[model samples]
Target: MRVPMILALVTVLAGCADSHRWSPQQNGSARITTSDRIFITTPADGEYGDNVYSGSGRNTAKIIYNAASAKSHLVRIGGLAENYQDAINQAQGAEQDILIFPTILHWEDRATEWSMISDKVEIKVEVIQVQTGAVISSGIIKGSSGLATLGGDHPQDLLPQPIAEFVSSLF
Candidate 1:
């Protein structure tokens, strides 16, 4: 009897553990040209359980890099840096065109079963001009991996889709 009740509660919570929805507000005047050289800044740390994932920032940057690299006009792609200023300094030193900053606003992972979990994440992206240090564009991207059965794929794998879509739309 107690086991059944516990199972029901787990199912309910699992169903409720949906991903975040982002309503991106864009700046109409912002423009990203095909000739721009791009640099992606590391994302901020995100909490998952008691430990914080510092790698989340770098991971998000990589996703953006991968998406942008496919474009022919993007001259060069910059790697992850410690923070926004660090990335800007590096981009400026390298004579890059634009610097991208990605921040993980919220990340949550809840265990649904012994082997399954639900993962949700929210990300904010900002584009800045490396030369003038002016913000060119800014938007929020959020998503989740709903009730994934853990084993074959990493839990946070699906989290990058929304970010990629948002970045792609900028160009």
Candidate 2:
């Protein structure tokens, strides 16, 4: 009996330390901020101070966003899914020497002021050169949005919007 009780106590203590088990707190509105890095590597023979090569090295890019259990509805999945997917699709279709991979997702719960009803989320992205594995350009983007059930307006909506803005700005 003593051994069983001790095991139970230890299990409970370990579970409490798990961050994923914690729920997101509400302050006022939910917000998500995302950042991405875009890099374009020069061709290998382009002249690395000593050598001259043909073609480009390997153009690469990546995008990382804060990780969290987000409700599909809150992200405008049903309503604005087309728009969101279209943007990424177009980027993939663009003419570039490198290949494009799906955006990697990362999320974590954020603490908010009790008086406020909103929470914060963050997203980031990275682009890398395939051949040389070098990062040419990188950037960070962030947005804040509303909480669950109440998904009408969210500050994080700016996340995707900035993606387009940033990509264009890169050129």
Candidate 1's residue-wise lDDT over 1-171, tens digit each? Answer: 999999999986775454655466655466678888887766666777786876766676777777777663564545556567777887898888888877777776555445345566777777888888878778776666556344333325655566666666777
Query: Any residue pairs clashing in model 1, and if so which?
Result: 43-57
Which regions of candidate 2 fall more than 4 Å away from where they truly are? 1-96, 99-115, 146-150, 154-156
lDDT per prediction? 0.68, 0.29
For candidate 2, lDDT tens digit of each residue in 90-164?
333443222122221222222322223443323333333333434433444444432331333322333444545
Candidate 1 accuracy as lDDT? 0.68
Q: What's the lDDT for candidate 2?
A: 0.29
Highest-TM-score candidate: 1
Query: How well does candidate 2 match the true structure in TM-score terms?
Result: 0.31
Give the total clashing residue pairs for model 1: 1
- The number of the candidate with the highest lDDT is 1
